[model samples]
Target: MDTYQTMDVAVVGGGPAGLSAAVTLARSLRSVAVVDAGEPRNAPAEGAHNVLGQDGIAPRDLLAAGRREAQEYGALFHDDRAVTARRHDGGFELVLAGGTVVHARRLLLATGLVDELPDVPGVRELWGSSVLHCAYCHGWEVRGRRIGVLGTSPMSVHQAMMFRQLSEHVTLFVHTMPDPDDDAWERLAGLGVEVVDGLVRMLRTDRGVLRTVVLADGHEFPVDAVTVTPRFVARSDLFEQLGGTLTAYPMGAFVATGPMGRTDLPGVWAAGNTSDLAAMVAAAEGAGVAAATAVNADLVAEDADTAMRARAERYAVA
Candidate 1:
């Protein structure tokens, strides 16, 4: 039942986006707090790519560095999950799993999305390792190697094309995805990509390392890495609790926001995967900064109005 002082801003989910926002708000001398559940979306990935000045850094290490930087700027962090949220007294209140309550004038949800991998066997076990998505994230490591794209959705064809740019040895396993159109088949053939038509039974692994893709028809193809198109579902429980509806997309669902991370919910904002499903680590960080600036500006306007009202009252009293 411990309650914290009402902060200027409360950021939920302490990943790249939340931490960046915390740093920015703290630098602006705004009282800010970050609540994290400690389960980062990229925790399974060995390294994050495309992050400038710290490319290929491990996900945990990057987050640790972000936490340190935010702390250095006087941002308070709670390593607990925000279990419940409700609007309160012209602001918002969040109840943590540990029983602490956080009160803030503004709420920012940087809770990243969850990657729901294909139901195929071995995919979850090897995720973030031999099983991967996003050509920009782990494509370089598998470059010039035997890369297999698991067909789970129409986007699987697009994935094959993306990986073809990185590796000459690319195979598209048409497991469950719809048959490619004539133009898609022609493009794949033009790129010399092998197309295998069969239901993928499982991904064969040896000593926890992926070795091959096994088909239901008893055929197996050796591969160095497999790509999948996971459905990206954003973490939006708290947002929903606050009466925010998730915007559905063909690939997944997310909380919709404006360019500056301002959500439709009043006094509530979102950044990172919560709003932008395609955002990478660097892009999430940028979104967080943008949301922080917007929140700070909103607060500045509110403060000015309050001051003006106070001055008017003072003159009347005099």
Candidate 2:
């Protein structure tokens, strides 16, 4: 590996967005480096669905391929976690966990989201397989399967309604939540969803395939799918340290960004789930492409101004 004095782009996180940005910048003839912590929140996920042509690829396999593709394009992959980021003279300086320093002209935060699932047993096992999160992502594959929409709040009422579009045999499990409003109740009944008011004990499954949900009342309900809106915590603490304000989301807080992932702070950009709470892997990659292009343009403008000033200085010296 060539010892890089400075990188044109420094992408944090090795997930889809970071890899996509690094690859694009490298192809554009820029030195790029990706800092990844080697842990994805979706590690337990059996496969990444909803990715066109690459559906059903395991999470690790998908990331491995991304890393390989980016590396092939001369993008350096740093297997260390970036702990601190401060604005430098030209761009930003990052301090990794082990005191490694990397200087970059631009930054991309692609650190993905972490889903805080329910405290119920077997959730980790069933998650990303029979137990799912996004309806648009995993709904089609689980169509016609008996599904349960576990309620963490009144929002589960809407989730149950959405899943009804996929299957008529959907059940809404109201785990420890109070009764829904009249309108919420009406929506469920109108959708023909079965509402259960018992705490979920365990989501019994087999080998990544789901079987049924066992409730605390000792009632085992046969369910082929379990949909719960797992809580989320943003993966981008680096952005927060840079004074980027986060907006509150129903699931979690995420870095606020412009259309192309440019944050309020200059020289620092964010894409993927770190900023886009609802973006899929494909969408995250697209966002990264857009952000990288914008960052490159910004840097080019900066370099042009610097060159013009130097020209004036030379003319005066003459």
Candidate 3:
């Protein structure tokens, strides 16, 4: 705990959420530190979209810009992960992946989620390049190109429909699904999508350009781009380790936060993807600002409470 002395606030993760939170807190004159593992989920994406003022920006570039903004505003950036968080006396103790310990009066967990992609051939190679997940991010670029959406969730058909809006050609490959509902079938029919019954054996390619899909039934569906709707697992185990409860969902999950991002933890708060999975870049920036404000307010209250108690004690002594 004494390794870094004391901090006003400590933010975990380095993606949109943590970066935004650190920037907001630092701008507010708080001595803030951001602990990042540098493993962003969208690292493989070519660029991100639907974010105000930063639409179509590359994920890594955006993160770098965020780091600069936060650092310039007095946020200390560290290339480490907060592997554990435990409650301390009126503060928090954070242990990084490298065994570095930092103590802070308040904590902000902006650790984002991780997506588990399927082990299809050439999938990882094309990730963040030609193979994308979010339609709002990459659909426009791949429009009219042959697109394939692998079934990974109940919302997968819905994602395919979104892609269909961007392209005339879409195929919803029925892979790794126990059974798709009638509504899914209906959506596919309405969107005029090709449905492949056989499992996806592998993806054929041409020097990083996805060419075709080899199926189980000795068939192939050639595609120029592939969209996947992966299941997101919230990387909030550090918070969970401290008995922090969360509301989990299929596509995403979030720690329950109040108006200003205060969770049930006394000296701990949350912002960004850790608490609001739907938050984009600009929105997360605003969220980080709000959460910092909330944390500051809590500190103010504690200060006031201490002062009032001391004044009362002095009068009692008199």
- On TM-score, the candidate that comes out on top is 1
- The lDDT values for all models are 0.96, 0.84, 0.81
Per-residue lDDT of model 1, residues 212-302, tens digit only: 9999998999999999999999999999999989999989999999999999999999999999999999999999999999999999999
Clashes of each: 0, 0, 3
Tens digits of per-residue lDDT, candidate 2, 1-318, equal: 123467888999988888888877878878888999988766767777878899978889988998888889899888999999888876888889877888898888989888888888877767777778778878888888798988886568878888899998999888955578898888788879998887988888777567888889899998888888877777868888887767887778888888988888988889888888788888988988898888888878988999999999999999
Candidate 3 per-residue lDDT, tens place, 1-318, comes to 327878889888888877877877787788988888898767767677877777888888998988999989888877987888998877888988788898899998878777667777777778878778877667788889898987766766877889999998999888875577888788789879988887888888877678998887869888998777666666878889989876877666678888788999787788776777766666676887788788878777887999999999999999
- Provide TM-scores for the models: 0.99, 0.92, 0.91
If ranked by lDDT, best first, what sequence of candidates would result? 1, 2, 3
Model 2: ten consecutive residues of lowest lDDT: 1-10
Task: List the pairs of residues colliding in candidate 1.
Answer: none
What local lDDT does model 2 show for residue 103? 89
RMSD per prediction, one decimal? 0.7, 2.4, 2.2
Candidate 1's TM-score reads 0.99
Residue range with the least summed lDDT across 10 consecutive positions in model 1: 38-47
Leading candidate by lDDT = 1
> Which whole-number lDDT from 0 to 100 does residue 281 have in model 1?
97
